[model samples]
Target: MKKGWKLAFLGLLAINVVVVLVLLIGLLSPIKEEPLPKASPEKEAVEFHVQSNKEDLNRVIKAFIEKEKAKSFVDYNVYLRDQVELYGDIAVFSERIDYKLTFEPEALKNGNVVLRQKGIKVGKINLPVSYVLKTARDAYHFPDWVKIMPSDELIYISLDKMKLESDLRVRADRIDLKKDDIRFTFQLPIEQ
Candidate 1:
């Protein structure tokens, strides 16, 4: 009986030793992790040509002015006729005076348009063009892209400076009022 008891105790001790060794090996092993993905390269910009007539361009210009009017303190209207016409009222000595400014539109190669002041009519009062432009610049809320240059007698419309959604950009290809041919190019950036 003593011999049998000694053998059973030795077997249980050997089993416990094997179990502890396995547990220690598992605890000492290093963990493995997955690698990260690489960044994608930037894609090229895509260009699309848009062609419209004077009527469509007029509607678009009217809509743009109407949209901007909501954010402006003074009301104004811009339309494409034989030339670019801007109609607005300016306050002089606490009195509102109606004014009509006609500009000859000249499209540049760098996607910008310069409106050279051809003529101006101010409510039966003969005011200097510079003074009226200065007054409009000071009083009316114009968009950042619409630069009113009083000294130069021209309004610079910087299309590149105008921001659009989805990283879109626009360029004026051609704007011939006499021919009624207006064209624009829209640049869209491709997603990576």
Candidate 2:
């Protein structure tokens, strides 16, 4: 109630307001943006390895098949089975599929690798490549990506046209099938 007490109360209120303003400014201040560190040109070409087990490959294939299943009208039980074999630079890929027929197509050895219709077994009969392709075309239509060459007895996947991760720019140097997992060696380049 006295002048000195009133002045002291006003001083305390001013201090509180100043403290609150300082706290608000500190909390709402913009964060500084730091540029990402650039790799030197000399070390631009860096080699990296991706080691994937059988389970990982199976899981990825299953996911892809599941996505395709919705659009696909033909009934099938197609899926990848075990480890992907790598002999030299070529990778061997195989899968089991049932298209009104249950069979495990032979391991296809094209550039990328996939399952081939050449030596697919149906029950006890081993169907020819042409027959398989004809059946697939007339009876069960395949996706646009699959290119079946009945003459060459070759089945290949068109991965070159497929879009990959935008940030990662690398080419596969070599693939090695180790005892436990598959190792993929990739050569990545740094930007100038």
lDDT of 2 by residue, 15-117 (tens): 9999899866754544333232222222355667777665676677667766765765544444333323211111113544432222223322221444333
Highest lDDT, which number?
A: 1
For all predicted structures, in order, the TM-scores are: 0.73, 0.46
Q: For all candidates, what are the clash counts? A: 0, 0
Worst 10 residues of 1 by lDDT: 33-42
lDDT of each: 0.78, 0.45
Tell me the TM-score of model 2: 0.46
Candidate 1 residues lying further than 4 Å off, grouped into runs, are 1-43
User: In terms of TM-score, which candidate is strongest?
Assistant: 1
Misplaced by over 4 Å in model 2 are 1-48, 82-111, 114-118, 123-125, 137-145, 167-180, 185-192
Query: Candidate 2: deviation at residue 20, Å?
Result: 91
Per-residue lDDT tens digits for candidate 1, residues 1-192, read: 999999999999999999889766654543232222222232377999998888998887888888888976777898888899989886645888888999999878777788899999999877667666766776777887777777677788877767789878787889999899889988888876
Score residue 141 of candidate 2 by CA lDDT: 47
